[model samples]
Target: MPETLPAPCAPEDARRVACIGAGVIGGGWAAHFLARGYDVTAWDPAPDAEEKLRRLVAAAWPALEQIGLAEGAAPNRLTVAGTLAEAVADADFVQESAPEKLELKRSLLAELTAATRPGVVIASSTSGYPMTDMQTAAGDAARLVVGHPFNPPYLIPLVEVVGGERTDRAAVTWASRFYEVAGKSVLTMDRELPGFIANRLQEALWREALHMVANGEASVADIDASITEGPGLRWAFMGPCLTFALAGGEGGMAHMLDHFGPSLKSPWTRLEAPELDRALRDAMVEGCAEAAGDRSYADLVAARDQGVIDVLRATGRLGGTTR
Candidate 1:
């Protein structure tokens, strides 16, 4: 174990951040921190990781700037570190985006715990692992928590904040406030759970999607289009619960539940999720290709970002509050 360093200054007064992995998610984390005016130092063992990190920042900055998320954001606030310790040294906040393997995360968190100040909160970007599992390897586990972000995090601003059994409530609250101030939707979980909220919800939809394609009910493109053209539009503003509430007229959730409750026990629905077999995977690839037509993944992602920006602006809900 390493000696404990001094406490970090207040968040507003802190200028430095450390990102432990420079992969896709780590790069996004670095971009968000740098865009918010914090100098970032990141580390990854992969060859050319530094260059990749720089490119990710370059690519994400323009989209963020277009939406005023990067207004007054300064350059030269990002750096790549040669080692894990080098990354977290003197950092105010450490954001880890390493691989999902438990042993790998344990080793990394141990190193990070040794390297950073005790007062510096170490936030993991792990989407599936429970916070308790991630913090177990840390010497000071209380400072570790889940700060999972959605992909293309610089543009889509939903972060699920989860605390381990030993995690400090103050840490969770401060983490929520920190992300909110940086223009993010922070959903704090009441308890630690695998996949958190968004990923679980996403997995549920994905399971059904896979089932539909596997059973020849729909093509991958058809499934995506079904949501993109239908529920996706409604979900852009309010979630499924709220949307159904409105669907129930003045009776709200009670009326909706009464009308749809019977479906809960229905055997017609494909309640059991299908496995992602090779055939389904190939079909999905082909379906996506068909959906793409001439548009590249880059083009599709940009379009989605623009649509989200438009919806947020139209609803007067962009960057206001996280409540």
Candidate 2:
């Protein structure tokens, strides 16, 4: 690896950002950086990648505009690069949203790390893979960190940042602060945990949901309503831990845990994932189709984007300062 370059200006002052692999996550990152008034160049290999990315960004624009764009924010500020090297050659920061395949990630990240100017931060949008694994092939693993974002990245503001074994502490700090500057709620994790935090919890719940479906215990719509009409409303503002704390009546987590700890052994949970057999797969697909009703995938995405914007606004997060 080449010697590390001196650290540059704070990420907030960064003028250019590169988004590699212009899929959903990459395109979302491009949309986000553009909305923040940064010049963004994106690269992906698909013949239709550029067109798809533009459409995705165009779809996300109204929600971002509703939240208030930066002074110079414009879609025209985005550029589609013909190659990965071209994309990150001059980028002050690079956000990679490539495919989840580990080998692909390892090779792509190494290439990205080599191409970008030294000391520039490179963040991956991996949901579950620890940075330790992804950074293995990077030239300067010290500058690589995971910057996981939620779906519909333009509307959702939460970003989970963590560094791998070889990552420099300064790189972790830099990425965390940079996400905040980019208008995201930063979860600067101290250590890398499997699936990070949110995905672990979500997967646990998701597994149980699949189990219920396999056992004919619940429909997809039932699962959705059980949350939307039940705990989902509270969860929008207060997380599950705090909500359970409130569940202890006058007491808090200690009391609630004391009362509910014994129930942990209850047979209600099926932690092991149900085999996704043809029947189960068809059921899930049909359930989603039924749930989507007359709406197309694009329609559902649009609805979700606007709904998330409304939730952020209601919760006092939309357009709020992240510094």
Task: Give me the candidate number with maximum TM-score.
Answer: 2
Top lDDT prediction, candidate number:
2
Per-residue accuracy of model 2 over 108-178 as CA lDDT, tens digit each: 98998888888999999998899999988888888888999998788788899999998898888888988
Per-prediction CA RMSD (Å): 11.9, 12.2
Once fitted onto the true fold, the runs of candidate 1 whose alpha carbons sit more than 4 angstroms away are 1-7, 69-72, 272-323
Model 2: colliding residue pairs: none
lDDT of 1 at 185: 87
* Regions of model 2 farther than 4 Å from truth: 2-6, 271-323
* Candidate 1 per-residue C-alpha lDDT over 203-259 given as tens digits, one digit per residue, 9 for 90 to 100: 878988888899999999998888866778767855665455445555544555557
TM match of model 1 to true structure: 0.80
Cα deviation of 27 in candidate 2 (Å)? 0.8
* Worst lDDT 10-window in candidate 2: 280-289
What are the models' TM-scores? Answer: 0.80, 0.83
- Alpha-carbon lDDT, every model: 0.76, 0.83
lDDT of 2 at 112: 85
